[model samples]
Target: MASPSSLLSQEQIQCICLDIFTSPISTPCGHNFCMACIGGYWDSSDVCQCPLCKETFYRRPDLCINRTLKEISEQFKTRLSLFEEQYAQPGQVPCDICTGSKLRAVKSCLVCLASYCQTHLEPHQRVGTMKTHKLIEPVSNLEDRLCKKHQRVLELFCREDQTFVCVLCNETDHRTHNTVPAERECTEMKVSFL
Candidate 1:
């Protein structure tokens, strides 16, 4: 008999919980993510890439809900809720580092790309190199911030292609395209709307 934790690992829970596990879908590459998560991700980009393996699919494949996984996930969720009420606070991201009792995350490190609770985040505050790491409010779907092709953080927006690009991407595929820091693009668009 598999333990509850073994039945659903932290990574699996993250993927399922981030998108509420509604209508779970499996890709041809054998990766599973919430249907809404993959749909929204593909809708924003030009290509269909698996969030976990970064496998690109030229055409969008037919999606079907995995009834068995869904049922198991639902059962697990019910059991977890019954085990601990108010496990995660309202509007708070759960600390990925916590094992038994997941705690609310206080900060997220961009360098490590992981959320940490107040206790686990101490190293970032105390260590010199870690102190330089950018910390922001906890965010789900950290993988979306990465470039699929280069596997680097998307920091720039390509005006010509109208998509996010990483630093390395700017030097390669988008070298000719007008590009600017993502922040600058946001600022420009906001100013234009005013």
Candidate 2:
């Protein structure tokens, strides 16, 4: 018998299965599966609990395409869009450091000088992992967001004295520049810049 972790990892598209099971037609959470898997793996189990996840399925399992699978597929499409935005430069080479596995680059950190796809990004935010990486989506205008020099935090807003400032900047450069809150400036700037 395959280990539970290995079982879930198998049969996933490119080993990227978020959730998958074998027997009992169940999910990792241990629901039940009959109708859903019968059409796919009927010869194996007329009634099967998810071998990968260990979920239990009730009798007379309903035959339906797995919505969970559909959702994951859609998420992959989004990842692709994010990758395009992050690597927008002409002739931008494929991510060489990432094992050449094609995944969506969903985030970038101006400070860290690194780009991360969906797979690596999650582990970066995980509790036990280092949380040093900053993440931003495509629509956040991350290209123009960095400081021309430091390239640290994005330029969020300027003070009343018109000094570009981040939250940290308030305490450093623009401390005496009649600082107005960024939220208020954002509200006003939207009308003109938008």
Measured over all alpha carbons after superposition, the RMSD of each candidate to the real structure, in angstroms, is 20.5, 13.2
Highest lDDT against the true fold, candidate:
1
Please give the clash total of every predicted structure, in order.
0, 20
Error of 2 at 174 (Å): 1.5
Which regions of candidate 1 are displaced past 4 Å?
Answer: 1-87, 188-194
Best by TM-score: 1
State each model's CA lDDT, in order. 0.80, 0.50
Candidate 2 lands at a TM-score of 0.36
* TM-scores, all models, native as reference: 0.50, 0.36
Residues 1-194 of candidate 1: C-alpha lDDT, one tens digit per residue: 23456556545744634644667788899877788888888899998888778899999989999897788778777766654443457666888898987877878877898989878999998999999997877886678888999888888999999999999999999999999998799889999999
Query: In model 2, how large is the Cα lDDT of residue 133?
Result: 56
